[model samples]
Target: MTLADILASLFPAGHAVRVTDGLVSGDGPLGASRLAVVGIADRTALGVDGACTLSRHVLDVVQSGDRTPILVVVDSDSQRMSRRDELLGLNEYLAHLAKTLLLADAAGHPTLGLIYGHSAAGAFIATALATRVLAGLPGADPSVMDLPSVARVTKLPLETLQAMARDTPVFAPGLDNMVAAGAVHAVLDPDSPLGPQVEALIGQMGADDIRDRLGLERGGRPVAHTIAARVAQDAGGG
Candidate 1:
């Protein structure tokens, strides 16, 4: 779906969002409350300027002192891969955007991500992955890292990486893999009204981050939750 289509489906009641340069920000009615919406659109490559812009909006929401739920609608390319972006410290800008979202979540705002289209790499992390709950619509393609890039980094053959991905959800790209790895908490039915599904998800959210546990239960990265728990326990004892 296009961003407009997704927004209409998500806010059947109404919305006041503005999209400029692929950056989205606004509010939408959500059953007795308003959801503060912020995100990227148009499959644009996220850059330092986009990251800083998003972070500023999130910080504005946080400072408002409203316990409003935040919705991050994502449709982005990977972080911009240009010499200019590198020289401008794109990583730091992305980190700031992620931190601002985390702060909003920590400050009693329920932060949720809805992926309706392509999202990848650091752009995915700073927006969708930072959210407490991430839901995806059918055909949402979110990739932390693509196989070609992984092959280059790991010095593994492309065919070998593809074969491994077939068996493991660990670093694969797709909605199924993301769900298996617990990056996506839910996949809404495209046949149904998305507004109700989004509302239900908001109602079901909890304070704890359960992605690791979900990953273990779903048979993706089976040792992650166990190792994390052990480390936490050991740190507390020390």
Candidate 2:
């Protein structure tokens, strides 16, 4: 089955799933009955459109407050390639949606994400902003795409590009690599106690905030420290 089909099975339906084109935004089972979900179809699922859809949904959820969960489901392929989208303020829309997500967290909402499909680039970044991130099995591919695609524009060689991807978390695919970079909070089996676990997370949250240490990133997960050390090094300090 596709990612949406799997998520539909995992998250019980109660929220108002918004569907415009092929983009869908909603709070799965943990969300309130009136939560907004949006979907995008075809090439229209480009930059500005996707960002606008996300912004609108986020705003609606923030206005709804603690009544619903902020569960984001990611199953995207890529961002806008249209030159018109580039000309338009697509970046503004992305920033707007991102800020709205932060606002949702501050307003006491459980922002959880289930990535059952490809979460590439902006779509991946959007989903990862959640309080908790869950990846189910090996169905998802999280590459920034192969170096050949980049090389088509940059004229870089396959060997050189492959070498770079070997060391960078940015180019890795699959959940193992993503988990190594702390991109996901946990990996759920299709038959695991996902629902109850999510509910437990909701109950344990004294406030809407998701604790970094309590989730999958901490508790001696090897990748957690690896990613952390990278960040620290990037920041120019220990």
Who wins the TM-score comparison?
1
Q: What is the lDDT of residue 130 in candidate 1?
A: 94
**Candidate 2 lDDT score at position 111:** 64
lDDT of 1 by residue, 62-168 (tens): 99988998999999999999999999999999999999999998998989999989999999999999999999988999999999999999999999999999999
Per-prediction TM-score to the true structure, in the order listed:
0.97, 0.71
> Residue by residue across 1-238, what tens digits does model 2's lDDT show?
3544444655664334555666776545543333333333222343777787677877787786455666666666666667887788666666666677767767766566666666565555654444443444556555545466777867888788778766764355566656655556566666654566555545555652223333234432344445655886989965
| TM-score of candidate 1 versus the correct structure, residues matched by position | 0.97
User: C-alpha displacement of 212 in model 2, angstroms?
Assistant: 9.2
All candidates: CA RMSD (Å): 1.1, 5.1
Weakest ten-residue segment in model 1 by summed lDDT? 1-10
For model 1, the stretches where C-alpha displacement exceeds 4 angstroms are none
The best candidate in terms of lDDT: 1
lDDT of 1 at 191: 75
